[model samples]
Target: MIYFLRNVDDKITQTNFRKALTIGEISGNVLMDLSVMADEVIGPLLCNPENQKGWPKIVQNDMKRHVNELRNLMHQLKGEMSSQIMLPMPEGVENIYHAEARLKESDSEDVDLYLKTNIEGAIIKWAQQIYDLLQEDSYIAFKRTKFPLPISDIEFYTHRLRNLEGIYSQLRDPRVKRMAHYLESTRSVYLACFKSMLTNVVAALLREVCNLVIQQCTNSVDPMSIFQGDADEQLIKLRKAMGVLNHFIDTYEMNRDKVHTFFPPGVMPVRWSFDFDRVFMRFNTFMKRLKMIDNIVEATVEILKLEKVEFSGLRGKILSTECIKVLEEYTLIYQNLGNITYDPADPEDTRFLSDYDKHMAVLEDVDRRLASLFSQGLDECHDLEHFFKFFQIIGDLYHRPIIKNELKPKVAKLLDFMHSNLDAVKEIFDEEMAKLNPKGVERPMVDPYLPPYDMNRLNRAISWYNAIREGSHETEVALIEKEISAIDHLLGRGVEELTWNDDFTEWMAEVYAAINTLQERVLTAQNNVRRGLSNIAAWGDKPLHNRKDNPEKLELLAVNERHPRLVARRNKILQSHAEFLHILKDNYKLFFNIKEDEESDDEEEELEEVDESTMDEDERLARAQKLQAIMEQWEAKRIAREERERERAEIAQAKFERREARRLKREAKEAEKRERQARRDEG
Candidate 1:
């Protein structure tokens, strides 16, 4: 009967009958049969019945085995529903079992009740123990890494809960049923707590690892300083830190299944996410610093290349000592800087590079300026003055330390050119002087009238020499001074040597003295001639006066009659003046070789003719007046002679008449006395 009941319970639990029956009905109908069988059949048989013969040992043992089996089946069913449902028999079933128990009011009935209550108590205790174990396993799995509970542990707990569910379906007790449902609810809550604990553990571990990596990266030395020392050492430290991070990742991958058992798919904890961003950001920063160092090194190498660079012109050929020194200093600076693998990112280093570039540009500009200074030659200049000024300016520029080397040779060439020009000028001076005085004889003084033409040429040469000397002096160049002084000495010697001849000076003095004396005599003669002409003119205008009383006028006429002596005195004075003019013309001709033109001589003769004609007219008038005076005087003399002759004849005629009258008177007396002596005589 117990086997039958066990089979019936298994069938009811496996089937869907619990959906159709109420908890009270299931308890009453299903579980009451076990109690009835124990009280009516098995209990009386085991206590020894009266109407039947006494059982054998085998039959008694069989009845006891059935009773024990019934008790065990009731215990398992009670444990399934003790906390879930209240246990009660059907309305008449309990009374039927109680009447059966009364009929068998022996020790057997008491024994059955004791066993049923003991099994129910044992079922409730086991269920509570299993629930407590689940809680403990979940806590151990979450809190400790060492000896953590495996997934099988959770599986074992889930298997026990399923068995309990099956038992609860068969049980007729409300208390046991309530206990099963409560354990099921507790199991769900513990599972949720276990999943949450796992997520927290993983997230906390990730946070700790990320924090360590962040600390390592942040605590490293400055990025620029890394280039100053051993760069590999710093890189190794970074690699080690990265290795630690990689190990953590590997560990996570290895245990991915264990973590996923608690956490759902695609659900990562939020706490450790920022650490990943920090790690990547630090890595990028480190890479950028490395690139900066590379760029700085490249620029340094480029700067070092400048030591071998060559300029394109004369500046390259002539290297000044100062420029060489500057280059050496630059090389030293580059070496000092090149030894270190400095950080290009450093602002101070960047500034140094910039300054170096600028200095190099300045050097190149200086080179070009020096090259330009030597490109043109001195001969290209317009004149000596222009060339001198240009040379001075360029010389001053080249005299600087950066451009001073190799300058002396150029200056020497210029001096040689000046010497040649000076020699040429000196030769010209000597040739011109030779033209003036070929014999180079000594003289007393320079002739005033016959000044040498060579002097004018010498003046022009001196002007040229002085211009060059003055320009050279302004430059203050020592090289040109010696030549200038030599030229100056030559000029002085030429001036001092120029002189006139002694004989020529004396002859000119004598000639001048003679001309002065002749001028005085000529002036005196001219005054006397004018006075004589005036007296002759007065004599022609005046009437005749008494000869005896005007004896002074008559004396003037005698003086005027001496015209031949006045004319001879005038001609001598004029001839002396003409000789003085001829001497002057000869002196002019000797110096300048000038000849008088015939046309000019003719014009002079015409002017002389007009002057002589004026003088002749005056002289002729005076002579004509003198001749008229003389004629008037001669006429008076002739008239006086004629008058005296007429008077004598009259005297003779009167005497003869008087004598004849006397004769006639006497003839009257005597011829009248001789008849009148013939008349007187004839009469």
Candidate 2:
């Protein structure tokens, strides 16, 4: 069964290749036919003596008629040939108007020169290639290398032919114009016919190859399935073929560009020589080798699966052979091209080496460029994988990871959508909040729900929520709806809680009313206290301000011992009160745990002194004496403390200086020892 499947698959791939081969064959044959007909029959007829004699009379009608037929055929073939490949089709690939114009050269168009140069060789090969393409293993001679036919040469020819468009447009002669018109018509017909054939051939071949590969892969399960089975070979082959296909696609595009233009290049004939013939051959060889390797790999894989086939070194050996070698060889080839150097100071050397170095540099540059491209592709693949991993993470949040593996991407996409439009959600909430009103009545202005007790913790929670919402898990529509509903509910509650309303207005009003009442009472009481204090002065019955006389002069020569004593007592009390308030109020919470109620009691039980209105002369004298003593003691203590602090600082500085000196001395000794050791060694 496996053999049958593999055979069937191979047949399909071969069939498709054969179809492409046939298209190339048929197109090649038609060109050959036209050339032969033009050369042997048409040219001879037009040039013959007897025919020439009668030609002038019948020329107008007969020439047009004859040309029309050829034109029609050419167009048909060109059309047929273009439709085979799964790539962009360039303009006029099937058109031969340009080719015919070259032959007649009735006009001085440069395309005529290009066509004349190429037509003979082109026709000759076209005729020859039909049979060759039919051969099972025939290859074309491209750059001295015999690569597979159709695959190798066709693209190159297409490129050359398409590049001839520019030359085609400049022709002005009636005969050349007629020929162009005729060729175009024929090209269209040819293209249409060829495309159908190519499409069929390619489709059939790929189908066959895929089937064969699949079979080989399956068959490799049995150890004794095939005598020399190697499954790894199959995988390698598949990869190679895939690579070649990629290369071919690129080359095809390059050729297509040439074909799409009307006025392409005057020197197309010469430039065409540089067509990707080698690339195409390599591609073909790679394709064939890949398919063959894929078969081997698949077969071996199957065998290994069945009863432990001891196939080890046999696998990757062949796959690894040319890849590394090719990479290295290509690298060396580019490197030998030249080294690149540029210096602002060396103009002469720079000038001589510029172009050569530039070209060589391109070769070297391509290595990094290619490596970068490879890395970029890998990075893209990795990014895609990471995207999928993120999707899996999101999936884990909602559904089982294993089950949601396929849907993870979908969920991730949903999260991305939500995140992208999060502002919209905020906008909606803002609109909802704006609808609330606040006016009239007394109540607490402060909110009951405090700011999130911990901002960092809140922010972290928000981040987690945002991550969940923005993640890439394949969330079910229902689940997303539910989440959205939940968010809406929270948003609504948040808006209601935050928005100012009737209750908030009432609370604010009440607070303001109470504050106004307290403020009025405080102002009245302060006025009364000020008045009472103003009426009773420490200087006795007279107002204190009126009684004061030359206070500064009195301060300078104060002979009244009581006055000085009183001033000292006043200053000490003020200083102690200020210090006590500072020490208690600043970082007060760290001190004793005096509750608000206990604090009130303590304030009530604090000492009371005689009022300024009730002071006696003897009592004042006694108080002044006590104050003087206290002031002297405090002054002496303060001076002593300052002296101690200064001494301590000086000691610290001395210690630092001594340590530094010792370190310097030790360093000097080490240096001296090293110098002495060096001298001894020298001796």
Candidate 3:
């Protein structure tokens, strides 16, 4: 009955076949609808015959066959609709089978279109399904395919096309042959576009990587500047670029066999040709550059070591200006090189962990050289003048940590030495004064009077201190004052068991006060002596009767009677005064010339001396005039000496006052700064 139905369907007239075509299309739709219902509802119902025993086996079988026939008709109708060729037919014929038969008698265009619509449509549909499977997830193409799957999309499509070609080979239809050709050509075009896009993307990434490598080589400074961020940033960027290139290579390698096939013969030797090898080659180049930088740093450190050796002999020797300049230049270069940080874990870094010591040695050398220069400066210092110059040089290098740490203690030691010498000198002066004055003898309280012993003692002490003060620079003086102030602060902490040596500030202050007291006493003594001389001259001019009634005058006359004990006391006073003046002349030559002026005048006066009895009258008068002129010259010299002493004393007093004022002001400023700092810390 199915064969009879097929014959009737094929033999239908044009009008009748047209009606049959409409009915067939409607019937195919109805069967499709039923096939869905059967799977969703009817098949489940039939699974248990007891549930729907009304439907017999024959009835179910017939319905299944009808569904299959309807599916075949739908496939045929799809092929006919896709055809661009109009299949020739007899007049008024509408049957699709007859139209197809007429089309078989046509030329290649019609044959080609008919075969493409009929067979190639199915091939295209199958190729599209494979394409969709390969691109299931856009981000991960074909990554989750089953075992034995095609390696890439193009390969998978090629395999499916081969199977379709084999199936169509059995048919003699030229249309089927053309459809196979069309499908193969379309697959080739699709694969070409895909490979081109992949190549472009890979080429662009390679270019970017190459550019980054160039930038790393050209723009980066030496490794020393890496710590400042420039070289390090460039290296990090290079590393990231390398990472991207590595990822692309990994992706390409995964599908290498399939994707590489897209390239025509003789175009690429293999998948690992220019594209793959170039990336790794550039990576190797970057690694070599990094190693080169490491070597450069190591060599720089070695050069610095050589410089250190050259300056090593300069230790303990007096530093000339040229020596200082050389040391300064070496230190600056060492500092610039010392800033480099090495990473031992990096493959390209040739600097091993053990080599870090070599780098540190360079830094140590800088410290050693600076410290040696400071030590040499100190060793060469002898007097206050030299000490001031040395201290200024040290101050210039004070900004270096090594100089501050190493040289400050040396400076402190020098100060201790000076302080000890000062104490010894002061002690000698005191002992001499004690010897001159008897055990129980008190200093006289009379106005404007200084004992001869006290004057001699003061003269020695003043000369010593004045020499020190005159030789020192102002800044050195200030440094001494700062040290003294620090000692005072420590003592003020109220620590009871302090050593005398630690109380240097107090000792220095006491010594200064003594000198000031002696200066005042000297001035007072000068005034008192001048007043006494004036009184004696006035008394000597008065009449004897006027002086005889005055008890004060009688006492003064007895004291000046040239009695033996009074005469001895007067001679002792004169001897002590002469000895004190001699000490001033010897020790304080920078300030005094008393002995020199006296000796010169005395020699000149002796030359002018002559006896009046041994010469004529005219020669005797000339000799008297010469003697008067010599006495006047002596008087003039004595007056100039006194004026010079007075001027020196005044200048010393003014200098002391200015130094004291500055010290007080500096102390006040320091206290205020400390207070502000404390307040800020509290807040």
Candidate 4:
């Protein structure tokens, strides 16, 4: 180290280096004394001066070796010193921010100054990283890292801050000033983040306490059932929340100083918008109000002269009908309480409110809950039974003296719907009674064996009246519920109930007598037809026993002119059967669920090819008239089709004749031209 030092001193003291250091550069040779520029000096051997010294070869070789060693040592010293300017960053990691170097008080002034000069680039890079990260994460990253800060020691506080203190440059050049600009901006951002985090901590506590208040109020459950929260768990949550808040306040007081020490003067606020006192006061107010509600509830039980009240929730919510009863009693008290005697002389004594005012306040709060619940509840009522019951319970409460005036319109609205349904049921009952199928001369035959009344429609009305009968709604609503039920018992029994009525029984008896007479006649006719159809094949009809006889369609019997009496007997049987079927069709109408096929007559006649010779005059004349009309229609259609075809042929012939004339004329023109050309050629 001494040898390197001696050589560096020796080289700087050379004549040319001395001249450059003292005399720098001179323009016009006048400012040689004032110029600050320095020029580099060349060695004599490189310049090859004319009068340079000529040393021995061994001596020159020794000087060159030591000079090369001195140069290498100086270069190594520069590399070592420059690397310490920034902290030793982990490999592959960008040197954004890290632990500050352990700068010692014993560091020489020049050493400190040298390090300060080299630190500008590192500080600039770190500031740029903070700026970009803050912008990218919208300062959320900084808040997570540095805000709501822990009670860390001074060592943790000092991390990444050494370069920003007083060590960095404050120059006008952008390179140096740019570092200061960014760092100053970053400090402002950090200060804001610290304030926001501290304030947010208190805000979160206040919000939690406010939520406890709401949960306490939302615990009410009554006829309206505005809130149905679990009571026991809510009570536990209230105490737990208070305990947590007390513990948080104690912890904040304990760490108050530590927090201030962690963030020095500019990074922390002296006074904040939110504080420990404000959060604690909000919690304290909630507890006080809770006690007030307790007092009001106890007073209410005493005033109503009721049995020992059992509390279900913080709010005066009860599960049974007595809750509504208490509200009813409270209504009476509320009216008397309105005549409060305030001190006349001490008008400023408005500080004390009577128990009546407190009760009214609670009821007003409940009134708001009812209004909200009713608006949503009435819209959800779909069933008639439920609508009446709901109105009986909740609507009656709403119509109380205290709550009535405010909720009168809603009560009237629901009653309108109720009256409309009642009117509709009455209408349905009247319409269905009119369908009794009265025993008159015309249209007396109802669906046979079915009830003369529309039992389904009558039962619908009966069931509706039953539904409305259960609940005691406030409004004066009466219906024919009892009368409708009696009518139902009489008429809606079953289809067989129709015979119990005298008019219907008499009509049914007459129908039965007529049907019995028709049945006797039909049996006689069928028996006669069957008896005549029997062929005495063993002896009476010996020809029918012939081996060659075929019964295919009975045509062989018809062809046997020798059996005229046989044909005549068969014809009489067929005619008699036809008369029997006609009698059945003309005399009776039945309760068939559907109509007979409308084309049955046409189809039967189509199949009635009963050897047209057998058809009587009436059937034969009708058939002949029908067949004649059909033939006339077909002949007229055929004539029209022939006329259309004839017209089309005439048009086609005219076209053909025109085409032939044009062809003949063109052929004549071609022949004449050919002859004229032949004559010209001969010439």
Candidate 5:
């Protein structure tokens, strides 16, 4: 019952013309014949099949059908290879019809072999060409780090790798024989190589891009230099770098089609032998490197934030203290006077004293305090300049958000401190005046014997009693002046020296300079700190400050008209030179070149583009020639002007030399005359 010697009878039975041949029987015959061949030829000829000497009609028919199927399968595989490998598109897809037509022309049984070899070779060649194109495009696109979605493009390439699996399936089919298998094996080898190459290229591109950005951001510390006059050079360097980067990115985009033309397969087979956990661990490490870079940028911004607040707070405190001291001292002079008339015997009167006593006792205390405070503040504020500049660099690297929560309390505390000191000084002055003069006397009737102004001694005593009274309001100069004048009339109109020997004018100069410096420093610190705080606040997942709209600062327009607390400071600096404000203003312009918005002049009319069809060759040539002539003339004029300027400068130098020579001659003549006079006197 066992089937034996099965070649003749089995082949006839498996034939579609006689017995109803099942797919299994046909497959069995192909494999049995495959086992009979020599081992080397078995694999190669089955893969290629051109070496087969003879074939049954059924096998020949089966080979023909397999050939067509392979042609279709290989085409699909080629597409997958192109896309997965990111290979360049070939000029035209190979036509299956032409391949089949060539196959039919040959009557030889090796026709299948011939067709498979040619098709397989063509597909491999096409894949390689596409891969080369992809490499070229990648090299150009290497500079374009931000390619909308390079990962997505890579994923597309991966998808093609997945489709390429179909070609592998066709190669493994028993019916394809050795020749077809050879083509499939070649494709498999190439796919393995391409997958590895692509993975490397993608990793390299990512690492290179990330590293470049990190280096650019990390090394950029001196932002102030950007605003300096030397910015042009740095700007040029940056622009060049950006242009180079842009060029690479443009190349990447332009060549993307060519790279994707091969539609290479996705789903590269992971090596079965490799450890999954180890691969994942390496991946995690790479991810952490990116995150660490971000954290470093954040930490830098925080450092800047701390520096801004610390320096600003210190500077603000010093300024507020100095301003209050000066104001209190200036108010004291008037408050010390009991009344307008100064009487020597009157207990409340201080006006009878000369400049030495009045200024020394009353104003010296205020002046000295302010000067000391100013000196200390100036030194401290100067020291902080370096710190602020250091932090400014950190601010530029990380755009720190301004958080209002941190700044509100600090600004409020500063304002409150200034107001409290001012109130305290005023209250003290009022209290001192109240104690000096007490009101206890009844109203006095006008008497003929008394002097018209209240110079009477008894009247002075009564006035003093009335002047030394307590009141809620501040003791101003007008109130104290009257009391002093009354005392002076009572005693005699003689002046005596006062103990207050204060150089107020000099003290004021110091106070003003200190306040100005302090205010400027505080304001700068506030700006930098606020900028950082706002950046932080904005960066958070949730906001901490009030988001509702508030009224705009309408009163800012009147800031210029507000009281001048630091005018004396500016005046002190400018006192030695006329137009000091102008000089400072000019110098400020030179140091800080603030750009102003200006209206662009549009006087020139736009020239209409000439129509090429309307213009003759002669006319175009003439226009071009004229333009060249004009450019030449303009260049010549520029050169001539430069020469003339040089000549004029030489002439001016010669004139200056002549004037100096004349002055020297006149000086010599004067010396000779003096010598003659001395000789005459001696004779």
Candidate 6:
């Protein structure tokens, strides 16, 4: 039963292959030696060598096949392969057991040393490899991706660790007891390190989520500025980041369990640097803030859903009050943003106002759009200033005031001016109509030339006037416009309506009036005849016609042609006609002929009478304006005449001077000569 190694077999552990036989020969010799020991372990107490179940067929009925079978099974015991499927490692286990049983003491010592060294070395090396693989990017943590299944990194790595634990089961043999104990202790240490490493990775991921939140709320690179990302996008990113942070906090216990229990073998839990409670509470503030703002934003969205709306109480313009109130609530939340803190000790303490301010800016933009819908007047029924012009048109149409309060005074003032100007012109027109005053006609002798007024201001006033009044004053306005039209028509006749002339057409107006009433005697005679005809019984009878009205009273009417009263009336009519013809002849001359001699005297005496200052303030100003214009013309002509005379006189005297002028020149020359002489002497 004892197996001994010879000199050449010792060459198997030699430095040079020259001392050893060929590889096949050496393998056969080693297998023969190993089979003898296998036979000893299998004798009487164990199975027959030929019937050993796991032995290779060559080893059945031949003791050499036992070692060959064990060695053959070792082919699958390569490091990773051993980990891949660790069940039924019979070759390795039996080899360890058989080595201690039947070999010589020195040879057995050699086998013990070889198995212990190789098996222990392999176990430690594989454990290190597993740890090293976990350090690699892909294997260190289970990859999170949007793939077939949402496999969590913790579960994935935990499953892999459980599979790796299978390798430990195969090492529990007496021959490798020391190796097993060493591996067990090493595995425990590695699992502890792995747990620590895993916890660090999760913590890193938690920190990454926190960084995302910081980027959302505050500036990452800067300490002061808040992030300015888009409002809708910011809201989305914040929600997702908050979810990730919460997930880490929620599964903290489960992750530690995975590291410790059979779930992931001998992994141990490690605490993070900062307290979990503090971290949770700190980030929860952001959630609280988000919840508060969420309500405001939702309300605002509902209110802004309307394409058009109207309300008041906004300063300087009109807009929707309900929507503004919602926006104000949002603003109030932002203004009083509390529980936000920064840590100088922690560079990651970047939860600032940029994200919230950015969303607030988005809200401000909405406000600006809404503001564009406001209008100052009824005519401003559009909000093209805002980008959403078409959307705001309906709001503009409903919200604009009929006339803004500030603009009222300007319109009223200018309208009053126009009204006054019209009245002044009307008064002058009426004065011109009174063409037949017995003393003298009060004809308006206004100057033809006048100063200009501010046409731009007037035109603006007119436009504003029309914009304020919504077409309902037409009846009253039209009645008043007749006077304006009359004045305008007269002015179109070239200011002549305001000027007087010596021509008799205006004076002839009185003659024409007289001609209209020249038959005054006809009314008197008709009245006298009616009285005489009243006494029907005092008249002689005349032929009566039944159809005639009051036939019995017809005698007075029929005899009126031949009666004494009728004869007197006829004679009086002839006398009145002759007198009327004589008067017409005289008036005709006065009407057509100019009284040239009295024109200057008459105009001078009636100058004050012609002034229509008593009519109104506007008329007084008009008259004064006329006088000022005449005075300017007179002053201009006087200055021009004086300039002409001076020019002519200067031409005549250009080469000549009088005695006084010649003496003054001589004295001026003498004074200059004396002054120069005095200065030269002093020098």
- Model 5 local distance difference test score: 0.41
TM-score of each: 0.15, 0.19, 0.18, 0.17, 0.17, 0.21
lDDT of each: 0.45, 0.42, 0.49, 0.43, 0.41, 0.44
Q: Give per-residue CA lDDT, model 1, range 1-683, as digits (tens).
A: 22222323344554655553444322444566665666676656664545235777677556555565565556556645543221222212223344334435653333333323333444444445434433443444455455655775565445444444443343425543333333233343333332333333344335344544544544564443533444345555545554665676667556653654666678863332223433344433443444444443333333333344333333443433333444565556534543445543333344435534554555455544444443333334434454565455454445444444534444555666687789998897776666675466643344587853334444444454544445433433243455446445544533443234222232233333433333333333334445545644444344333233354665534454356646655565566556546544553332232335422332331111234355677776876676677667556656765776799799768746754654565455544545445664454
| RMSD value for candidate 3 | 41.8
Error in Å for residue 591 of model 6: 99
- Better candidate number, 5 or 6, judged by TM-score: 6
lDDT of 3 at 470: 72
* Residue lDDT tens for model 6, 290-363: 45355334424333444344432333244455445555665455444433354221343444345555655655
Best by lDDT: 3
TM-score of 6: 0.21
- Candidate 1 vs 5: which has more lDDT: 1
lDDT winner, 1 or 3:
3
The parts of candidate 3 lying over 4 Å away from their true place are 1-318, 321-356, 383-391, 394-406, 413-683
Listed per candidate, the RMSD to the true structure in angstroms reads: 61.6, 37.3, 41.8, 37.0, 34.5, 41.8
Candidates ranked, most accurate by lDDT first = 3, 1, 6, 4, 2, 5
Stretches > 4 Å off in candidate 5: 1-257, 260-288, 301-310, 313-398, 401-683
Candidate that would win on TM-score: 6
Q: Please give, for residues 248-288, the per-residue lDDT of candidate 3 as tens digits.
A: 55765677757777788888534533355444555555555
Going through the candidates in the order shown, the clash numbers are: 37, 67, 0, 0, 81, 4
Runs off by more than 4 Å, candidate 1: 1-277, 318-331, 334-683
The CA-based lDDT of model 4 is what? 0.43
Look at candidate 5 and tell me the lDDT of residue 661: 59
